[model samples]
Target: MRVKCTVSYDGTGFSGFQIQPGQRTVQGEIERGLKKLHKGQEVKVFASGRTDAGVHAIGQVLHFDTEIYIPESRWPNALNSLLPEDVAIQAAAFIEEDFHARYHVRAKEYRYKVSRSEVRDVFSRNYAYHYPYKLDYVKMREAIKFLIGTHDFTSFCSAKTDKEDRIRTLYDIEFYEEDDVLTFRFVGDGFLYNMVRILVGTLINAGRGVLDPYRIPDILKARDRSLCGKTAPGSGLYLWKVYYDN
Candidate 1:
């Protein structure tokens, strides 16, 4: 049977989602649990995408094939018993064998938080990016408008990306602030490696008056990674959700 699972994890204690040889990784841990459950047989798990080190997830999705049959409702508890405290199985169900967690994805949502308070919140230091400097939220919102819709996001992606096609569609970009915490919610068909972080960093530049909001269009047209701002820290990023066409 093919089992689809939704999971959440605190990326602080993990190297990343993918399995690394020696480093402690989310995939390695989960697979290890599955191996124990399967009586030493290897169970390969596939995820929707990879999260970089220090990135968290509220609704990450993955799927794996298993020979053992268990009630869908009890799968969580059974897996949780074997998994570590930082990683969790939120939900699990039997999915069609043809369904794919990665290829069948319809959209993804990523949320980034910034701490705007002058005095750093020690508790949230590991969860949010602390930028005490004042930001012109108005200019940042204006810059985001240029980034909406379909476009080649080469300038917003990492130079290490191997994907040749850089075209992607942004369904929406939501910016809001409450109690001095700034939130950026992005929904898109897909994202390139480090694309969202690079965009956030550039938007910060716009907020800082270092780059004019009107220049966003020019930057996109340039297709030059050097023209973009620095990539935001992975700690501030979260994989909020993954959508499927079900």
Candidate 2:
């Protein structure tokens, strides 16, 4: 049966979601649990996308084929028993044979969190980026206006990325503040390597008065990585949600 599962992880303890030899990865653990369930027979799990080290996720989706015949409702409980504390299966269901967690995704939402308080919260350190610098909220909002819609986001992606077709349709970049915390949510068809984090960093730079908001258009047109700002820390990033056409 084709099984679809939504998993959540703290990410602090994980190297990343992919299977890396000799590394403690989220996929490694999940595959380990699956093997345990299958009496040592290895099973592979496919994720929607890979998140870098220290990146968290609340609704990361994945799929794998299994023949254990466990009910969909009990999949979570069965997997949770074999998984580590940092990772947990939130929900699972038997999906169509053609349903793919990655290729079938129509859209995805990624969120980055920032704490602007002078006093740091130790508890949130592992989950949020502590950036107490003064940010012009109005400027950040204005900068994103240039980001919404389809365009080549080469400047907002890591140079290490090999994907040449950087054109992505950004549905929206939403910003909101709650007291001392700033939340930036990005909705889009897809993202390049570190694209959302780089975009957030560029927007934050605009808010910090280092870059002019109006220059965003030129930056996009430039297609130059040098025009981009610092890449935000991975801790602040989260795979918020994934949407499907079906």
Candidate 1 lDDT tens digits, 42-68: 999999999999999999999999999
TM-score of each: 0.98, 0.98
Error of 1 at 223 (Å): 0.8
Candidate 2 lDDT, 1-246, residue by residue in tens: 999999999999889899899889999999999999999999999999999999999999999999899998999999999999999999999999999999999999999999888989888898889999898888988899989999999988989989979999999889888978899999999999999999989998999999999999999999988899999999999999988876
Cα deviation in Å at residue 217, candidate 2?
Answer: 0.8
Q: Candidate 2, which ten residues in sequence have the lowest lDDT sum?
A: 172-181
Clashing pairs in 2: none
Give the residue spans of candidate 2 off by over 4 A: none
Report every candidate's CA lDDT. Answer: 0.94, 0.93
